[model samples]
Target: MDFSLSDEQRAIQDMAAKFAEREIAPHVAAYDREERFPLEIYAKMGPLGLTGGVIPEKFGGTGMDHVTYALVIMELARHCPALAGAASWASGVAGVSVLRFGSEELKQKYLVPLAQGKVPAAIALTEPHTGSDVASMRTRVIRTDEGYILRGNKIWVSMIKSCGWMIAFGTLDPALGRKGVCAFVVEPQWPGVTTVPFKNKVGFRPMETGEVAFDDVHVPASHLIGQEGEGFRVAMCSVENGRLGVAARSCGMLRGCLEEALDYIPSRQTFGEPIGNRQLIQSKITDMVVWHETARLLTLKLASLKDQGHRARQEASMAKMYASDVLMRGAEHAMQIHGAYACSDDFAVGRFWRDAKFMQVIEGTNEIHRWLIAEFALGYRR
Candidate 1:
């Protein structure tokens, strides 16, 4: 039960930390203010292998292990979760599906460019009406002599315009339920594909999240990921990676809250004395430390399980659920400690608070995870 990071892992962690402080920290406020994706920052990340840590070297990625990948995400997220998320979308969430299920031609076309950070990618499973209920998705795909014709709408798709391609899931037949699900690689520039950006998001404003409408878009046969009727499996397999990424980001957010609160506490004065002298303030700081450590450990445990090739569905849910909850609560407490200043955009704690709420909603809602954790414990699911 060795818990310490290996020398290589430590080096990678340090490198990511330096990159975040040097590259992302300076631009976070401006990007968030403008609600713009930092394409230039991502360009730098591609050359540093930050954009493709999970991908294989053969695909032009750094071929790092999952633990190292988690560490990188954690470091990047400490400064900007949006940047960490964009990196994960390209490397783990979107790229892993193609790496595992995509054909050789698909890999050569998408993964090569994705690993190089030349283009980002997106996964479109959530629809206008369906989120967790994937089987109930209204998107439909019809088989044609040329390929597949897709007609459906996907919402909350991040990096819509910037992604070179996206893996979209749709049902072949409405009556077939999950068995009818099919996944396809759809290029955003196709004739029938249209995207509408979601504006005024509470958090992750720097990310380009939007709705994508595929109106009878033609997809080449070679673009299909895995076999027909296998889209459900493809979507399910990617959850672990998605959950792990969210958990790692939550840990980083928790750390950010702790650091922000710690920095402000002593300097803040109350009753002509430092707020850090108050026991209540100290207690909140203590809770932040505990939450950060707990989240990090759970996230790392899940990452280790993945690297060992173990089935960690339950663990992934647990880590994602707990870490996100901690992030939400920690951000709240940090805000509370900051008092009126927390509400202002001048402080990072407010940003953390806004972003923390989204973590609980994305990956899987905390409510859904609670149900899953209990079901796994009761032997209702395996």
Candidate 2:
């Protein structure tokens, strides 16, 4: 099988790499320290088609393939995962969901603006009590003659403050379980919607995270995505895209750790010799290299499968689980190699370490993925 990137993909990758180095790298530390979302950077990305690579050209995006989109995310993430994450959330999860399930009128009204980066998009699925158990969400929705009335609370809603619209999932009836769930597009400026931003996050500090409360918010009938009782399917479909983005970002973090360690080993000396000469150090570097390549390959494979129009749920879980695990391990090794300097803000490895740990938790935790992978392997799931 061919494993090489096409010429167009390579060019896109190079362009994204240059853009990240020029536009994102310099501001990483400041953004992290200030806990500020870089709206200006996203403004720049809008014109470059970086924020909407997965969206169709008719929707004001580049209409790029999934593999190319993955490459762009990887390059952007190499310098700043948070920036990459915001872009991914917009294009991959929120945008894709709208495009896949929304009515034509909804697409024209919301998806176009989102694709153009005229507005940001947010998804509210995880509640205060439910993290990975999306079907158990406590948010309640009632059908009305005009539309739907939603009332509930959601935590860890990313980009809530800046989002023009949010995709929120709620249950029509508590007794019906997953079958009762429904998805709606809610305008954040509505009368009953309120948000409180979280601060001092250990990782992804630059991206906004918050809790949202909807108090009988009135949503028009046109805002409902897909048919009623299809919210579970909508959430699961969007999660595959989220997992792919997470895997790509994890691979990029792994590459950053490898590069950081390699750069340090040659300059650091101990007992009158460079640490690069030590077999243990060499072994760590070797493992880092292997992990980075392996994670990247798995991520690309998943992308390719998606591009081929396959469901590929198992592949998404595997790539997301393995790549995130690799990123965590690679960050730890890089920090160990850097020693005391890693704890200091002077080195980027510390940030990578902090961010790496979060990757294992988002887009479905590694623990859940482990169970899923096993179930898939044993023919318990298909």
Once fitted onto the true fold, the runs of candidate 1 whose alpha carbons sit more than 4 angstroms away are none
lDDT of 1 by residue, 1-382 (tens): 4678889999989999999999998889889989898999998988888888788889878888889999999999999998888768755657888888999898999988888888888888899888988899989999999899999899998888688899999999978999999998889999999988788999889878999999999998888999998999888877888899999999998898899898888788989999999999889888889888888899999999988988699999999999999999999999999999998888899998999999999988999999999999999999
Residue 367 of candidate 2: its Cα lDDT?
97
Write down the lDDT that model 2 would get.
0.88
- Cα distance off (Å), candidate 2, residue 195: 0.9
Per-residue CA lDDT of model 2 for 30-145, tens digit only, reads 88889888888878887888877778898777888889989999999888998888668656668887888999988888888887777888889889998988888889999899
Least accurate stretch of 10 residues (summed lDDT) in model 1? 86-95
Report every candidate's CA lDDT: 0.89, 0.88
TM-score of 2: 0.98
The clash count for each model shown is 0, 0
For each candidate, give its TM-score against the true structure. Answer: 0.98, 0.98
TM-score, candidate number 1: 0.98
Q: Which stretches of candidate 2 lie over 4 Å from their true place?
A: none
